[model samples]
Target: MSDIPLIHFLIVAAALFSIGLAIVVTKKNLIGILLGIELMLNAVNINLVAFSRHDPERLGGQLFALFVIVVAAAEITVALAIILRVYGQYGTVEPDKIDGLKH
Candidate 1:
């Protein structure tokens, strides 16, 4: 099998990050923003695992990527709960429309 170039992975990661950033910036829904954030984190994970491949012994980057995956999972759980609660209260997930809950 042919070896993949690091630049290829880097380019993909950069594209993912840019698309994610755009989603985060332009999307009105909180869930969409969360998805964008996930995309960005996945891009970073790709970079980490790709780099780790070069260091056959250490695998530190890959381990860190796993840690990140766990953290992201937990974050999604919490964020989704918050989003659902907000939706229940306000009938919407649009960030601009939320403006905090009243006392």
Candidate 2:
């Protein structure tokens, strides 16, 4: 069986992270930002899994990646709830237009 190189994994992770960052920066909608954040988290997970592949006994990197996934899931749930509430009150999801919270 042929094994893939570590560099390939690193390159893919970098690309995914860059795309996620770009989405976060360019998007104005709350959901779009959330999607970008998720993408970035997945990129991190990929890196973790890739590294963990080298040392199968420790499984540290894979464990950390699992933790990250759980946290990200919780974060998205809370974030979506907040976004819904904001949309309910303001009738829009654009962050810039929702200035009621500004103090």
Candidate 3:
């Protein structure tokens, strides 16, 4: 298999960031926004892992990235719990429809 270039990684990261931003901006559902955030985080992880390939230390960026993954998982759990509670309080997950907390 051919080795992937740095430019290829950068291109993929940019695409992922753009898509995540678009989803976050256009999606009205709370869960959709959460998913977009997760996507962005994953894009960051890809960049980290790709760059870590060059580091002789080998544990620098990649180890931090593993911590990031754990933190992101915890964040998803908390966010999902909050979304579920909000859904139980309301009938929908649309962001604009959540007016109960506005006052």
Candidate 4:
């Protein structure tokens, strides 16, 4: 495998995290929020793998990244189910318009 500088990986991760944060903050749809969260998780994964590669004696970061990936997968399933249920009940996925719990 060709070697890559750590800083380059970190920069990419930071960019992904920033974009995901913006999407999470400004998006109205539940699915959009979920997508943002996934993006953020992927950014974290990238950092973890990059760090682990530099210290191959211990694979802690890589293992942790694997766990994060598994957790994100589970989160996607549950989040999509919740979003679908909310959309079914209200015919909308916009956060501001979802006020059914207040009643």
lDDT of 1 by residue, 1-103 (tens): 6789989999999999999999999999999999999999999999999899878899899999999999999999999999999999999999999887683
lDDT of 3 at 56: 52
Clashing pairs in 3: none
Residue 88 accuracy (lDDT) in model 4: 84
lDDT of model 4 at residue 95? 95
Q: Judged by lDDT against the true structure, how good is candidate 3? A: 0.88
TM-score of 2: 0.95
User: 1-103, model 4: which lDDT tens digit per residue?
Assistant: 8899999999999999999999999998999999899999999999999999999899999999999999999999999999898888888999999986742
Judge candidate 1 against the unseen true structure and give its global Cα lDDT, from 0 to 1.
0.94
Per-model TM-score versus the true fold: 0.95, 0.95, 0.91, 0.95
In TM-score terms, candidate 4 sits at 0.95
* lDDT, each prediction: 0.94, 0.96, 0.88, 0.95
Best by lDDT: 2
Off by over 4 Å in 2: none
Clashing residue pair totals per candidate (backbone < 3 A): 0, 0, 0, 0
Candidate 3, after superposition: displacement of residue 88 in Å? Answer: 0.7
**Tens digit of per-residue lDDT, candidate 3, span 14-103:** 899889999999999999999999989988888888899767577677987898899999999999999998888887899899887741
